[model samples]
Target: MFGDMMGMMSKLKEAQAKVEETKKRLDTVLVDEKSSDDLLKITLTANRTIKSIDIDDELLQDKEQLEDYLILTLNKALEKATNINEAELAAAAKDGMPNIPGMNF
Candidate 1:
């Protein structure tokens, strides 16, 4: 019985390791956001790192508004990326711990 318990524990540990690895990989995925007017584009990774930004030349004519637009676009992009990352992590956690009773996994 003790050996059986030990074996089960080992398998659980292995599952945990796999889940962590999968989460890490998903965390590196990227998301892109474009402004409604298509004047600005921003790309961010699931870890909230900005990958790149593209701005339309026509939109650059208004310097003050350009800054605001860029800021808003980046903020929205970051928010989206964060949400995606969280969902993926939550899913992985649930899948990894599904057998735990009474747990919201």
Candidate 2:
């Protein structure tokens, strides 16, 4: 029983390491979002870090419109990034997890 516990603990540690490595890898995965009319574009990493933003000249003419574009586009980009980040991390963790009887995640 003690040996089993130790093995499980080791597996859990390996799983955690994989998840952290995946997180670092995700920083290199880019997600792009653009407005419906293409007036604004946003780029972010799977880790949800903003990389860049491109705005059309027309958007610069109106501050409120620019803000609205930013809000909508950024939200869309973040949603995509969140999805990618979660899926990758979950896969990494699952791959390293030890199968203990009666335990399901």
Candidate 3:
């Protein structure tokens, strides 16, 4: 019985380590997306932090359009980041975790 308990404890530790590693790997993934005919671009980290922005000279000629394109590109980058993060976490969990309670997607 003691040996069985030790074995289970070891397995739990391994699973926890895997989870932490997956989180680290996810953080390394960066996503970039463009909009407004490639005049607007947004970069984001896997943790959903916006890293940088690029706007074309022509877009700045019209403040209204620039604002709109900025908003659109940021939104698109965020959306893409969300999708990537979810897919990565889901894939990682599927391989080992198998959907534990309270660990949302």
- 58-79: candidate 2 lDDT, tens digit per residue: 9999999899999999999999
Question: How do all the candidates rank in terms of TM-score, highest first?
Answer: 2, 1, 3
Candidate 2's C-alpha runs over 4 A off are none
Deviation in Å, model 1, residue 7 alpha carbon: 6.7
Cα TM-score of candidate 3: 0.71
Q: How does each model score on lDDT? A: 0.78, 0.96, 0.77
Ranking by lDDT: 2, 1, 3
How many steric overlaps are in each model, in order?
0, 0, 0
- Candidate number with greatest lDDT: 2
- Candidate 1 segments whose C-alpha is farther than 4 A from its true place: 1-16
Tell how far residue 56 is off in model 3, in angstroms. Answer: 0.6
Top of the candidates by TM-score: 2
lDDT of candidate 2 at residue 90, scale 0 to 100: 93
Candidate 3 lDDT over 1-105, as tens digits, reads 687777756655666677678778867788998984899888888768888888889998999999999888888888888888877766665555433458654
Lowest-sum lDDT 10-residue window in model 2: 96-105
Cα lDDT for residue 17, candidate 1: 77
Candidate 3 or 2, higher TM-score? 2
